[model samples]
Structure formats: C-alpha cells, structure tokens
Target chain A: MTQKYYAQIYVTLRPSVLDPAGVAVRSGVQQMGYDNVEQVRIGKYIEVTLNANSEDEAKTQLDRICDLLLANPVIETYRFDLTTVSSEVQTS
Target chain B: MTQKYYAQIYVTLRPSVLDPAGVAVRSGVQQMGYDNVEQVRIGKYIEVTLNANSEDEAKTQLDRICDLLLANPVIETYRFDLTTVSSEVQTS
Candidate 1:
C-alpha cells in the first residue's frame, strides 16, 4: 500500500513589498475603534494530501509543485510542514 | 507602556463546502506527473500586529475582528495564535 502524506503550506509577501491588502485591513481595524493596529499582512494557507511510496519521494514532488505552480516568485515566499496522514498516534 | 501583540491566524473552509481552487491545484499536480495527489484545500493566513493594554484585551479584540471581518460564517472557520511582539526570549 502507498503511504499517505499531508502538508500545510504558508505563503506570504516579502516585508519590503507593498501590500495593499494589508494596508487596507490596518485602516479598517483603526476605523473599527481598535486604534491599536500596527500592521497586517495577508497570505495563503494550503492543505494537501497525497500518496507516495515514501516521505522522501513525497517531499520531492511537493518541492516541485510549490516551486513550479503554487507560489508567485515576484513578491511572495513560502514554507511548509509535512506530516503523515494517520489518525492514530503512538505514545511512548 | 502598551504591550505589543502579534497574531498568526489560519482560516480554512469547512469540509462540506466545495473548493474549486483546491480541485484545480490537485489536477495541476497530477498533470505535472505526480499522479499520487489525493486532496487539496486552499485557505488564508493572516498576520497582525497591534498594541494592547494586556493579553486579555488583545484576545477580546482578536475574537471580534475574526468574527466580523476575518472569516465567513457561512463557509469558513478560523483559529489564531497570539504572542507578545518581543524579540527577547527568556530561557531557564
């Protein structure tokens, strides 16, 4: 049987980049009387599950997928956490 | 002095809803030759920084903001981790 893998990827804009959405949200928070808002940046969170022979193979595929398609190279950066998709947890 | 707080929020779709973006990514992955792709879901990650009198006050504001603006009641749900925006770490 093939192994199951799940990954959560987080993609965000570079700090130097101008994030219009973040600015808008910041202003909105102020208007809402939260007056304490300092900064806000929005990003993407992607969850994916896949089948592979092993974690190493799954990782290679994940790297390609993120590099080739999931991210915008111009202003955004990304990171991911991979885990086995298992319901049972083993405790020592 | 006011305390600075930073929050990382994760918003995701409910399992019952249809996610076209997720479907599209899964297809793209499979087509790219990583035929093991099983499922995909797309969501939002938000980073916010603010000044508050205390952690309790920050939590109250965070809850309100997420309820009113950050997530959709009809289809999405969200969670956040709040931390003080301090660079110094105290280790025992």
Candidate 2:
C-alpha cells in the first residue's frame, strides 16, 4: 500500500548573483509590448512525484535534499511545497 | 500614467541534463522517512516587478529576456506569467 506524493520546489539566485537571464527577460517583455515593464528576474521550478508514508517524513527528506543538492546555499535560494495523493484514490 | 507589472519565470534543466540536485533531494526524502518516495528533480524561480502599458508589449520584452539571458536553451528551459498592478492602486 504505497502512497503517492508530489513536491514542487522553486529555486532562485541570491540578489548578489548576477541574473543575466532576468535582465534579458526584462528586455524581452519591454519589446513584447510591455512598455511599463522595468525590471525582470529568473528562477526555476522542480516537481517531484514519489511514494511516502507520512508528510513529516517526506518534509524531513525534502529539507536535506534542498541543503545538499536542490540549492546551492552560496548563491541560490530554494522553497518547496508538498502534496499527497493516496494510492486508493481514483482520477477520472 | 505608469503601470506596475509582475512576472514569474520558471527555469529548469532539459531532461538531457543530469540533475544531481534532484537525485540528492530524492535521497533526502527517503532519509526523512518517506519510505514510498520514488523520484525528484530540481529547478528555479524568478519574480520581477516593473512598469508596463500593455500585455502584448510586456510579453515581447519577456520573450527577449528569456532568449537573451533568462534561459539557456542549450541545457535549461524557461517559462513566464505576467500580471499588472495599476500605479494608482494603494497598498496599506
């Protein structure tokens, strides 16, 4: 009876890190007709699906992942949310 | 009159790119007591607030930013959503 879980993680550069992508996007928005646009920043989203028994356990593991690999504390920051889907549930 | 705009960008590694962070997060989830957990992948998020007159124009600039800096099409991918806030609006 394995339970399914989904986690969404967002990662971004620290304000100190130069975000060329953000700058570029800002420029693009202006060109695309957003005359009022002034600044732009860029980041990432990671979605993970897995099986877990409990939310507490899943969260504990997620934190470790963030610290060890999902984010580089030196220059990037990360945040995440978790959701659970029971194996017994049906999707139509 | 100047308009305020908010843009959220999500960036991720192409499936071809080896995601060490994802792997690490997966491992962390397991350690955190998520016995049934299976897989994890990591990515980024960027938020930008600026001034824009029209959605079309803003979109254009956003696209340029993505191509020029926000996303590295070679190994990373990006997407964005835009919202407008009138300068006349007050936040208390």
Candidate 3:
C-alpha cells in the first residue's frame, strides 16, 4: 500500500540580498487597508505529496533532495516539514 | 493607528509548465524511504508584514503590489491571505 507524505518547504533570501519583491508586497498590503503593517519579506513555499515506506526514510530523502536540487545553497536557504498519512486515510 | 498585517502568497507554475524542481523533490522523498511517494509540485511562498490604516485599504494596496511586482503573471500564478492584529497586541 502507498503511504502519503506531505512536505512544505520555505525558501528565503539572506538579509544581505536586496528584496524588491518583499518591498512591493509590503506596499500592497498597506494599500489593502492594513496601514499598521511595517515590514514585509517574501519567500518560496513548495508542497509535495509522495509515497514512502516510513516517515523517517521520507524525511532523509527529502533532506538530500533539498540540498541537491530544490534549494540553491549559494544564494537561498530553505526549511521543510514532512507529514505522513496512512494509505487507509480517506481522500475526498 | 497602525495595524499589523501578515500576508502569505503562494505561487506556482501552470500545469503546462514543466516542473523539474518538483520532479527532483519527489525522487528525493522516495530515496529517503518514502517509497510510496507518487507526485510532487513546487511553488513559492511569500510572507510580508506591513502597516496600513484599515483592513480594506491594506488589502487593496497589497493586490496592486502583487500585480505590479511581486508576481510574474506571465508564467506563475499567485494567491494570498491577510491577517490583522491590533497594535496593542503583545509581540515577543
């Protein structure tokens, strides 16, 4: 049976890098009626669902993937979380 | 009074767009012991905190910003959410 795993990865730039996208979002939020908003930062969120034998193995594989391809070690940093669901779980 | 807003924007490639990153992540998860993993998709997550006068205004501004700069409408699509907190709320 195939077990399902959900992973969320967040990627962001180091503080030193310029964040034009973040600034634009900040300004947009302010215009949207949140005048109190002060600062804004932007990043990437990646979600994946995969089949795994066990939670531990899935995490280990995901780590390697992040290091090798998903994340660019030279410029961006990333953090991820993995969750497992039994194949028996109902999917609507 | 300044209001605080937290916005989360998720950006992803259209289904037609090839997702090499997503494929890499899926393979990585499988390698880690998640043999059951089947498919994976990758996208961007953007978080921003900004100051605005009212909730409505902030949302409008944020929309403009997203259209003008934060998102690349040509290739990527994005969705966002906004939350407001009173300035009096404690920040640790």
Q: Write the per-residue lDDT of candidate 1 for residues A1-45, one digit (tens) a residue.
A: 677899999989988899999889888888889888889999999
* Model 3 per-residue lDDT tens digits across residues A1-92: 54678887888887777788767766766666545557777777888776666788778777776777677777788888888765567767
Q: Please name the candidate that would achieve the greatest lDDT relative to the true structure.
A: 1
The per-residue C-alpha lDDT of model 1 at residue A92 equals: 58
Residue-by-residue lDDT tens digits, candidate 2, B24-78: 7677767766555566776667787876557787677667766776678899888
> Can you rank all candidates by DockQ, best first?
1, 2, 3
Against the correct fold, how does model 2 do in TM-score?
0.63
Please give each candidate's TM-score: 0.91, 0.63, 0.64
Angstrom error of the Cα, residue B7, model 3: value is: 1.7
DockQ (model 1, Cα)? 0.77
What DockQ would candidate 3 receive versus the native complex? Answer: 0.46
Please list the residue runs of candidate 2 whose C-alpha ends up more than 4 Å from where it truly belongs after superposition: A11-37, A40-44, A54-79, A83-92, B28-35, B88-92
